[model samples]
Target: MPASGSVSVQSLDQFLAEVEGRAFQIARIATGCDQDALDIVQESMISLVTSYSDKCESNWKPLFYRILQNRITDFHRRKTLTGKIFAWIGLKKADEEDIDLLEQIADPNADMPELALSKDRFSDALIHALEQLPARQQQTFLLRIWEGLSVKETAEAMQCGEGSVKTHLSRATQTLRAHLEPHYFSGDHHES
Candidate 1:
């Protein structure tokens, strides 16, 4: 292989390695299941490597995120379809295990029980608010706020116009604020 080709491969590997953990977290939040999140991240990584490895390095972040979003959408669609089928078949489905939101927080030493409880409450409220958002709003908020994408980049990732991204973000923020305001500002961090 040419030296340039080798360099590109190395760069791609490093990029994937660095983003994999956060991508998994994003997928986990979107899917609400550990195994499904793992599958989505794996599939997104493979899709990016197979289809978009040749793109410019600067373009990789948005592209990878776009792919991840698509994978999450696909996962949700499959889940819904399967659920409908199961209902029609009169079959009982097993309950899904709960995923710990605080596990995603980067705290290697969680020695303080009070701090841990506070974080747990915040994480629960945040997750509930996020899950209540409309799909487009959730996508826009996650890409723009959580991932720190520009409006243009977020629009590109969601395959929408910049105005649409902004509108969705505005609605998402409003809804989140309404849902979380009481819990956030009431000074009730302790889980009673």
Candidate 2:
């Protein structure tokens, strides 16, 4: 409440708590690896706090997303590089299959478990469609539509021009529409 950049500790903490869940969702979608997504989200939060916490509350969304976007990009880069190096070395990286017992059998809170499993038909379809999109398109759609960032704010967060943001969103929308409309309008929404 002091100024844009210099928010009180409580305010900043509140902001992080509010955004963390959505950030994790976005990161999970982008990375397709839970542990990597967790690391990226945690690193992004730390980055926003260490580097830009003084920005106004209004500015925090774009700033935080900018950090998130960068972290995700770095992750993709590292993944690509690792894949290349392993291929060059003639070693196939084994998929991670060691599951923790707690993680496997833990009972999350009731609503959390239900909400995670029981997406409505449309919600499930939308998430499926979203997963098929390319990374930039997915990021653009999520930031602009899902996250409710304006064109300008999305541009700032994405480190791209507004025109680029518009192009990405338009392409993503078209793809999602093409992918979802048929399924949605079909007999998929009714209960037996």
Candidate 3:
């Protein structure tokens, strides 16, 4: 209806706005700390706006995710290196800040009674299972399943081959099933 360039820009703006919340959530999952997640998401947003704004709208999803993934990986790398150095110098503390499992679990609930309780359990189990997965598998599962990206789009976002994405997704799904089946499918409140 409008000029093509104007339409493209408008769509891009809409796309970014829609994805921003999800991107922050994804970054938060990747980074255990809230502050780190916020920083990573902000940097990724800036990078995407500056470098990839000219990209086709169709290609923006994968590009934005790839940038987010790179930022997450960079944060992990820096943290790992800093920890190593601190350990080498005997400056690292014996007890690090423990992430509370219950607190980390998202409560996807409202004032509803039965639905809230059941869904909360599932959400907790899902987040725990996801946290146990390797970084690549976690990324693949989140991109492919949670985000509903195609295998090709996931591959691009992960900077890997399609086969690799499939492999990682398969492994992640199997691991999640193993972790969740006893509690969910069996109807048993097995304490892990």
Candidate 4:
């Protein structure tokens, strides 16, 4: 291979290694389907390699995320449009299910205490509650709180306005608090 081609390959490999997990997480949140998420991530990887391999390394993360986000949004749009058409035609099956929200919530196993502690239990409960939020809200909350990104950065990654990011994060926090409040106040014993 030519030197330029070899360098591009190395850059693509490095970019994929660095961002694969994050890319998958973002795609999962956006698509809400594991298979779809995987497909989108793979597609994004290929797209990045094909289109942006020659770009500066510093520009890779946002560009990769932006491409993945667009793919995810496209999937949502197609799903919505299909659902609408099927519903209009009265051909939509009641049993047809989309993504399961509960499974999408971040597990607190990595952060939770092994010993039974109220605060630990509360945190786990909160994490599960966060999973129950809408996809966009969960994304915003995680990007802001867990990822520790500034509002502008989160907005840029999410391809949305800063105001929208703030709104989503606000709603996500409120939803999580409301869902966790009962368990938090009840002093219930959480088994380790």
lDDT tens digits by residue: candidate 2, 18-95: 888788778877877778878998999999899888777899999999999999999999999999999999999988
- Cα lDDT tens digits, model 4, 67-163, are 7767877888888998899999989756435554333344465466543366557756875676578878987886688656678877887889999
Sorted by lDDT (best first), the order is 1, 2, 3, 4
Tens-digit lDDT track of model 3 for 67-182: 99999899989989998999999897564464533333344556665666677678778877888899999999989987889999999998999999999999999999999988
Per-model TM-score, in order, reads 0.86, 0.84, 0.84, 0.69
**Colliding pairs, model 2:** 4-55, 4-56, 5-54, 5-55, 5-56
- How well is each residue in 1-192 modelled by candidate 1, as lDDT tens digits? 646643367789999998888787778778778788889989999999998888788889999999999999998899899999999999968987775642455565588777777777877899888977878898899889988999999989899999999899999999999999899778877645
lDDT of each: 0.85, 0.84, 0.81, 0.74
Q: What is the C-alpha RMSD of each candidate to the true structure, in Å?
A: 2.7, 5.0, 4.0, 4.8
Query: Residue 81 deviation, candidate 4, in Å?
Result: 1.1
- Extract clashing residue pairs from model 1: none
Judged by lDDT, which candidate is best? Answer: 1
Steric clash count of candidate 4: 1
Task: Give candidate 1's whole-model lDDT.
Answer: 0.85
Clashes of each: 0, 5, 0, 1
Candidate 1 has what TM-score?
A: 0.86
CA error at residue 9 for candidate 4, angstroms: 2.5
Q: Over the full model, what C-alpha lDDT does candidate 3 score relative to the true structure?
A: 0.81
